[model samples]
Target: MPSQPTLAFNRDHIHPGDRLCVAISGGADSVALLLAIHAANTAPRESLGVGLSAAHVHHGIRPDTESDADLAFVEDLCIQFDIPLHIHRADIPARASQARETLEEAARTVRYDFFRSLIASGHADTILTAHTLDDQAETVLLKLLRGAWTEGLAAIHPIIHINTPNQRPGKILRPLLQTRRTEIEAYLHALNQPWRDDSTNADTTYTRNRVRHELLPQLRTFNPSIDQTLANLAELAREEESRWQAELSRVLPQLLLPGKPVRGGGRSVSTAPGHSSLSIEIERLRPLDPALRRRILRAAARQLGSRLSFDETSRLLALCGFLTLPTVAARTGASLHLANGLRADRSPREIRLYREKQSANPE
Candidate 1:
């Protein structure tokens, strides 16, 4: 396990002033993160300064007793640390019913929604989540199983800005992103901190749990460094993506139609009409590099109103051949659709991309 001071210094880099909210689910990883941050703040590290508060969201998805136990554990820890504790109870069942969503999605949405509310209420500028290296590996593996794109394989970010409407903008900081779960457990043990173990985490019904219990163990038979390999892949992917995004941002304006807004108002990108609508011109894409062209296509599609899968991206790239003909239309010969209202086009410069109008009350 890493020394507490080392971990504390890492947290100080992510969270400087004594003004951050630590999200604690009463799990070992979160508990350890909370304790580490707290210890660092109170430690005589003149260079590192920060104050920490505990934020707990009760999803109310599990049995009442289980939910109570998690909350009780966090409350006690906060009291022991003499830090402020915020508890938010969410009606998960009702939310699931209303949204017609699974319990997992509902609970996640509610938890973050409540966290955003805390930020809006001036609780903290940044919210800390305890996502360890194991979590990152699990996420990368999950995305790989589903045939993820390069960006998807980048895994969970150390810091992400939550951009939901009507909520105060805040960042989610993962100070423990590089720390392993084993190290977290060891730290908790050394501190004599007790945490609640969620039974759902062990349930094989979830893909992540199944991967953790079944697939990982099987893979370990051949390669003991499977997790490390996956983590390294994620880091490389992240670096590549950062460079790619910067280049795209620079080139996109020249490629897009005139007077288009690049961002804002729920629109990811916007372009004005020229010869043909910006949306139609996108259908004419062919000269751009196959890799970058697909990224731009996906981004445009997402802005329009749809998401493209990895397979869809491949199909879109194949459609570029149609630009040789006078007509700018291409078809996958399947029900699979590409983003931006594209069909079959035989010309690269003539194809345009269009933004789909958002439904007034999309489900």
Candidate 2:
């Protein structure tokens, strides 16, 4: 039997009456989380001060035996703990094929959709997932390797607010984000509890698994505590990103003008019928520092329901004549089309970003 390990759960954001649902995948981290919460509810001193339930998403990625075993394990575990369980069966393969996404992406999408449904149905207000310190480290490394922006470096957020149109926002919490995978396994072993292992987790074909097994081990040779170091980097990035967001909130209103029809200065500009757009004055935008300019452009796109990548933002900058030495030829009347029907047109005085009208049928 493994020695008992101290399990830590961050319940600071959890409230007394909040209905909490633990997302258990029958894996070590999630299983440990469910067990720890159940134990805490039984002990007043360590209690989360909330009612607890469990949810499991069967991705159905592998053979029936493997997937069925995981579901059975989770069901039995939940029954043993006397916790109400919400089970979702996701056709991940079909979802991926239809959505043109990878199996991993599809699984994540469907799983979160189920969580949101639980929130919408009032079954739970907050969903908890077992994202460990190791996961955070892997995420940070992945982002770094991918040349991510500063915000991307802030990987594995502890709290994610899920906002649906006209509905109260729900939260997804990572209560075990600071806990290590080893610690989680130790905790389960101490209780003589078993967990199901997903075969895909060992497949190096997945980028994350490669990072976990190959890259992280290689980095450990250089620094024994690389995981903690990377996790600290993510913390720092998250704090800085929060500050940047506050700064942007203060700066955007003064610079951004709504896309509503405007007629003045001998200029007439309006989006297509039933379309919305946002425009920023070229003169005001050009004089600002490059960093602020880029952030403003991205923020404006976000408001228009689109996220601009670094290259896309840079292209927009050049289109707005902000680039001193242009890499891509950007001139007036040059319009850029982006994902989700978003279009950017550079006028004489301003650059307007709007979603182009979508046709009901296309050949």
Candidate 3:
């Protein structure tokens, strides 16, 4: 389509002879991806000894129309192209209720869960998905509408990390991120291949769908280059996020102070609270840059298995600054109780984030 190398994805994420598992949905983007990868494997290039595999996830909703030969088309494509295919059916409604997630989120979770399992079972080295530049544009806009921070702006990473607890962590590569949807459709059209058109894509009730159909068109009137501009902004944020994450990883551990020791026991368990406690000396933490300080605190909260939202992270940062001074603590200890069983306590010595603690205003 574009060129051999550009057609597939960034080669840095997948090595020569590495087996790649492609997530396909019988849609144009995914069909184009599989076709592109197939083309790459057929051609002669340096570091081109790559293996191809496909997976189709059936999100068990709207079964009335979903049963229309989508899987059969994928299976036949894989058969014709000689690529291995894995088909999975998920109970999205039940899964969503159990996880307190919406049906869309649940479908995503199930799909990725299966993707990670493939890596764990030694089936593939990397996961490739058909996320395009337009998807990146939509993601950036969606995050912006939700009052996102800098990290949120870093949408749709080309090489994304996959952390499925208890399974081997893997990475997902998006080869078509630089390509537009129109290019993908054209690529498939050039091959005389037909793809399943999911009716759900046109449903404007979904926020992403609305953003794609309504907001993007309106925004295009102001700046015809809005998609490219948004994509560029995302790329810039991704570079900055990489640097910031590396720095945060280094600084967060150093600021942590071990919790006080146990009173008595045969073998005393060292009460050193790691990043999970969200605890640090007020004197030790107060001197750092506000940005760095907040990152550390956020890291601690994440360690405890709860990600602090942008609003929550902002609220907790106020405590980091205010609690370092005596006037904030005053008499009996002051604390702020937050969601996810998090409690930020100030004892005039250190600021602590712990679970199952009631806040005392101390006013």
Best by lDDT: 2
- Give a tens-digit lDDT track for model 2, residues 340-360: 778898777778888866768
Model 2 local distance difference test score: 0.87
- Model 2, residue 184: displacement in angstroms? 1.0
| Candidate 3 lDDT by residue in tens digits, 25-138 | 999999889887787777766545787899888787667457447888899999999999988888788999999998889998899889888888878878999999999999
* Regions more than 4 Å wrong, model 3: 1-8, 44-47, 163-169, 260-276, 322-332, 357-363
Model 1, span 170-270: residue lDDT tens: 78888887888888887777766778999889999988999999998888899988888888899899999999889878876666552222435322343
Order of all candidates by TM-score, from best down to worst? Answer: 2, 3, 1
How far is 270's C-alpha from truth in model 1 (Å)?
A: 13
Q: What is the TM-score of each candidate against the true structure?
A: 0.82, 0.89, 0.85
Model 2, residue 108: distance off in Å is 0.9
Using TM-score as the measure, the top candidate is 2
Q: How does each model score on lDDT?
A: 0.72, 0.87, 0.78
Ranking by lDDT: 2, 3, 1
